[model samples]
Target: MTSLPEDPSPMLNEADRDTAVQRLQQAYAEGHIPHEDLDERLHQILTARTRADLVSPLASFPEEEDAGTAFTIAAAGGRIKRQGAWRVPRTLKVESAYARVHLDLSRAVIEHPVIDIELQLGTGKAKITAPRDAIVDFEDLHTGWKDTLYKPPRRSVSGGPTIRISGTMGYGRLKIRHARR
Candidate 1:
């Protein structure tokens, strides 16, 4: 079964942080927190490395939820593409059979710093186009005839989402590349 990352930080996307910020602003407007405290909390929320870091600041506010949740795509002898301003989930499961899977995250909303992509491909191709600053990890991928057109990051990166791609492929190909600026 495909699963979430060991740490849930990757699940807290920019929208989540923005929600927390709005909550903080609301609290400040209502005099729930002092100006100094609000400023400090906002800083923390902006630089939060993990979801837990946003909890304390947003403790008094109700959690802002997104129903989009985990994004799942399945293609059976068809093609699938993800692009534009769609919300990114902590976990993404993609299954393709004699089809093509295209994931473009250049302008997509990213929730987690370490996004996990579970791919189940068969006689197909999975192509992912990510931001230039983003990193692609395929160490756990189990496939046949793998081809990557871009230079993979050497190590885990900060400030941008790191896509961790993994899964089974039968006579399929996987490609990870940076989006054209």
Candidate 2:
């Protein structure tokens, strides 16, 4: 006999309900959902009591769907660190003010053929780094800075992975550094 994955419906909570509704609204505005359907689904989601109930209506948006192929990490006035295995799509977005955003792509997979980064800050900064044994592809690169610093170095690792970042930065600095294994 084979074991099946456990259902996640029991994990749904009040907070999840709120988040799901917000995402649904955003999807509607982004044209991911039609107005009539949005109205019907939003009502159901608001009254949903389980994870399965909440997620059933969201099937139209794949869990891995990258609406804009963009992943965002933002800190308004503090520091934020995101590590572990992650999926990188076509675009990455970071926005902060007096804060920092760091992406440690030591065990991440870059699936997009062309990766782009777009960052905006009021008085904050952003950083994206990869592990030593990673492989990166940077054929299409675009970065912008406004009243801030943007620093990315060029180097190679003997047995480390590579991270290719192509994006924009506004009003802040972006520093790309290497992670020590």
Candidate 3:
């Protein structure tokens, strides 16, 4: 094995990388960093070499509360849509009774390896477009009338995050699809 003389710091293991990623997500959840910052830091965390190199990626966030943040989006009678470089929280709860909800993550910045979305909807359609390599799970979802429309990817992407969905839909359709590469 070859070693660099200028840097003798120990290399990072998978566990170290995972921890750093968690810290980054927590920071974003607490509003310490924006979506763009999270994207950059996520790339840095995933590509860092040594433990010392992890500093800059996990630098900004301080523990404000005991837990990370969860977002709740509620709508009444119109359409709820999010797309184009939006921020995705670690946990999201979408509530609606008569609104068309659309969440497009194909161009969003997602740093965490897992995101949970809970939906409570009635009489409105919901559509979600995930990243090209993401894995979406609707196993915990229950629909009142129509079934959810989701087709799994033909091949899985290694290291891709999992999007878990759990909720109750009433007389509305839930559509989940992946982005084109």
Candidate 4:
């Protein structure tokens, strides 16, 4: 009787290992792989003994280089442009350590049709601005300061949209401004 060959490919080259892992994670996030199966496969890949062991499954997805960035935007059905009416999902989350993010939506139309503008921060500061009518909702605002003159300015327009700002700040400030009608 003849013995069949075992599957190989999980044993990828050192340079390609990280890329493979990232691709797997992306696939999992995209719902291409089932959760249970992904977990099992990931375990196998991590314990892979040789490059040949990693070739089979890795071939299922397209090969690509890894782009290093902590924050990732998965805008499936939204129009992101330089100038125009901008309509994004109400829930916006800025997580982890972000040194600074300046958003200027002066020329864009912002409608608060969603629930709230969520901003979750770990470290650093973020500055966001929109039309005066835009609603700003901050769930948790934490400024890690004992006593200082610098305080996040909060403003709202009369008979206009509302602005909500909520998040934790570590010695940082949040400023909100509305367009003059």
| Candidate No. with top TM-score | 3
Give a tens-digit lDDT track for model 3, residues 1-181: 1111344359887877786787788678657899989898999989998977877887767543323568999988799899999888888999988999999988998867888999999888999998879888899999999999996667776656799999999998999998876
Residue pairs in clash, model 1: 10-112, 13-111
Per-candidate TM equals: 0.61, 0.42, 0.65, 0.40
Q: What are the root-mean-square deviations of the candidates from the true structure over C-alphas?
A: 11.1, 14.1, 10.4, 14.2
Off by over 4 Å in 3: 1-68
Candidates 1 and 2 compared by lDDT, better number:
1
Number of the candidate with higher TM-score, 1 or 2: 1
lDDT order of candidates, top first:
3, 1, 2, 4
lDDT digits (tens) for residues 1-181 of candidate 2: 1111246756567767777777787677656778889878988888787777876667686343544445676677787677788776566666676777777675666543345565555555666675554565543434445432333335554544345555445456666655565
| Model 4: CA > 4 A from native | 1-85, 134-139, 146-159
Model 4 lDDT per residue over 27-98, tens place: 676556778778777766676667665665555654342222122332222221233455443444554454
- Which 10-residue span in candidate 4 carries the lowest summed lDDT? 74-83
Compute the lDDT of residue 27 as modeled in candidate 1.
69
Steric collisions counted per model: 2, 16, 0, 27
Assess candidate 3 and give its lDDT: 0.83
